[model samples]
Target chain A: MSKVSFSEEASVEVVTESFADTPDPRLKHILTSLVEHLHAFVKDIEPTEAEWEQAIGFLTATGHLCDDTRQEFVLLSDVLGVSMLVDAINNRKSVAATDTTVLGPFHMVESPPRDLGANISLDGNGEPCVFAGQVRSSDGTPLAGARVDVWQANGAGYYDVQQPDVQPERNLRGLFETDERGRFWLRTVVPRYYPIPDDGPVGRLLTATKRHPNRPAHIHVIAEAPGHASLTTHVFVEGSPYLDSDTVFGVKESLIRPVTNVDDPARAEHYGIANPFRLIEFDIILDPVRP
Target chain B: MSKVSFSEEASVEVVTESFADTPDPRLKHILTSLVEHLHAFVKDIEPTEAEWEQAIGFLTATGHLCDDTRQEFVLLSDVLGVSMLVDAINNRKSVAATDTTVLGPFHMVESPPRDLGANISLDGNGEPCVFAGQVRSSDGTPLAGARVDVWQANGAGYYDVQQPDVQPERNLRGLFETDERGRFWLRTVVPRYYPIPDDGPVGRLLTATKRHPNRPAHIHVIAEAPGHASLTTHVFVEGSPYLDSDTVFGVKESLIRPVTNVDDPARAEHYGIANPFRLIEFDIILDPVRP
Candidate 1:
């Protein structure tokens, strides 16, 4: 045994050997690298004991602030832009196709499917509009029998899922399959701009950061065909107040379009609409994914 | 209203004009900056859709894996070095002062305090050693009555808290006060090197990064003197295998010291120790804090 002194190292062993066998060479390699990098970072910026403890405490609170209906952490991610980062990396759009945006935290497991040309608006108080759209490949080839899942906030920018008691079960939300020429149309009220859910830690974060939580008024669409990459994009009303500054950063330049007020009684009659009704037309172009 | 199109900035007005009110400037600024930078990062990487989804899933899992006893996210922060960065910004050490390190995930509240010269090693099985040290101001002035909280691993390098069921509470942990000459001495067992806890997301991250999780043997020490900056640092054992490559990068060359062995029977009688024993003597110098 070597002599033990409180002098600079030369005699005593500074580190101990491994206590247990670590299986999985891959895991071992990954863990070792992580430890080395992590350690290096910590050494670079030495923190006080109190500050370190405070950070731990903050993390503990963030964990406790999570539950079934309230995912403050997810909202945090959404605001932080990690959600979009992941979406962008996973769903790179073709040059000719519409760009994808964040799938906000409001999507639930199931939405009611409806027939094409059917009206999804339960309350008839907002601006009456007919939404007509086509699903096509990037090369303009129509995709027959494509499915479109669509949902949007009411005139007040609240969705059925958000105001379950106020809105009917399927209000402003429907799934429709395209016809032979990849055409899908529906009659509904135009969506309105509204604030995001603000009753949790995410709200506190917004308050702390001094950011508005309002998302632009837009229709959420998820279009899919068997061989093509599924498209989840949004169509913002060209005159929506929050377009330039969507709270969740879920807007694109290509998807913004005018809602025209048509006065021709004959055209209105063909679509079973009263004269001077509002109209919105959108086209979705998807790209085929490589197998 | 103007006949709005995708190119028209009119959409911005419509979206925000109808909302309750515009967000405060600070939040708006932070959110906008964050969005810009985050978007830039995404564009730079341009990861595939699947990879983006996987990144989202990783974040989701990171949030889910957090709880009272464990915070994988904080560990993530520690490993990422962000925690240290924040800490460093908050705690800038004065010149000649001991540097701080990561607080680690362990470190429960209220380590049972003990009187000066008390033995913290309860196991009684490891190689017996004496630890004697002094607390002084940077200019070598003794700091009498300074509080010193110390703890270390056992002969096998496991904290009592790590082996709760086997080791007695408060084993190898103690609190002491400096004497008039700023001197402190205690009898204890030599601590050994050990691995950090590796059963959480931090562990998974380590595995993914190919890094080892071993830490060199060291004693934790927190010294507090009136009107001076308190220090939370470690007295690293010299010659330890992991000293040069601490998993957390906590080892500083100035802090490493050898634990010497003594075999003088007469001297052992004077200190009431066995003929063959170990001795470790060191000093901790601290910088004064104005506040």
Candidate 2:
């Protein structure tokens, strides 16, 4: 074989040059930058052949782990914090609107529509919690008819998809709308912090990195209204164990809502929940669409 | 929900800190650097959510495309010039050994051992060629009995594995050993340049990038002997169309051997071949094993 004599510098140059003719300028720029960074990573690591092979095998396993029901790559991105970084870059809130986070892989299923104050936890498990919130614009004006889609793990820290036999379909998931006053409430069990699926490659990566796979207990919410930019975020339970180190980096200090123990029988009856149940109030603020 | 403002800088810090306790220091360093580069890549691209999703889908599809026989991820690496970069970084020759290139996915099957001058091209399909080479140490001493494993695509630019039904099993692959003088020769058809298996996600990426997926015609070789470091490389055919722009960037000027068209009938008869034949001489130089 001939010796082409490739230095680390030359390798990067060749790769970036290859993408010069990419028809899409944005794609070309992205690809060129990607080559530069990726090559830099290789040079920095200087991985042996065995290590490179191991990486290939790990990536292959990650891909195989995904099916119609699971998305391992997204989980990979989330665990590595790339997903949150992208989200942060793309959704720069202007201080008036609520901050956004990852739309975790679980949002694949569309929430089942229900009336306000509906019980989403159909299995009747875990401590009853009444979640009440109002949808408002950044200006403090209530946004009537805003759609709110919510989903959360059961008290056992498992979603309906994870325990199809034990959990009923659509358990702890619902789609609700703001009333004339932009107030909406739902009856459900308090969500517990849960481990992200870790039996696969991403899970292996977490374990290998000495990092816990648990996410802070949180309820995903996607609120959208005409004339407002849609908001996709999570309302984390205050004091959750993994809040400070949520495996997916989805937690935001502003997104944390304290759960209060409600002893008032009148309020419990009004919200159609048992006395001594937990109550969490989270208000959603959406930014108006740019004119 | 409380408002926890997250800047791009904070996201990287959180991720790097999460891996601080990784038991393996190398892994910890690799993960940290990976996070830094990956997050930087996302920030540089600022890809739309749809673009991000598209990338995830492409990666998932690449994985799905791999089975026991195919490796789409490796192909992805190759087309992105990552595979070559890894090869280049890991195999930094000190001017005493043959240059290394990618051990492409097709080297799965073991080469059948044969005597010197044995014909590897069983179908007798393309222009016959005599591949002769000498294995020597960097100090110019003959390295007798060095094992040379060689494989190449047939005349139609397809490997036996690629067309199992059409090509005979192991049609163009052989394992040979140098004689006492460290010389080995073989009778085989001259290989033609071929496009990579680009029907998968990687191929789609190449198309989108306006890059060709054709590799220069080359014979894969692995030469090993006692007291010397093993060599994994390719003997590229000079003047091959994609020599200057190998889709995988595996081509090296030193590895390109000019093919000589010999019309001498006497020489063909001596080598037990047709009158008109091509010839290429690629001398292997092995680096001595470090004490």
Q: Which candidate is the best by DockQ?
A: 2
Per-model TM-score of chain B: 0.80, 0.94
For residues B82-155, write the lDDT of model 1, one tens digit per residue: 44454445546666766665455556645666665667788884778878789999888999999888888898
Interface RMSD of the candidates, in order? 9.8, 3.3
Leading candidate by lDDT: 2
Q: Give each prediction's DockQ, rounded to 2 decimals.
A: 0.15, 0.57
Please give, for residues B34-116, the per-residue lDDT of candidate 2 as tens digits.
98888888888899999999999998998899898899988988887788888887777769688889999999999999998
Best-matching candidate per TM-score: 2
Candidate 1 lDDT by residue in tens digits, A132-187: 88999999999999999988888877878777788888788889999999999888
Provide the global lDDT of candidate 1 against the true structure: 0.68
* Native interface contacts kept by each candidate, as a fraction: 0.13, 0.70
lDDT of 1 at B290: 76
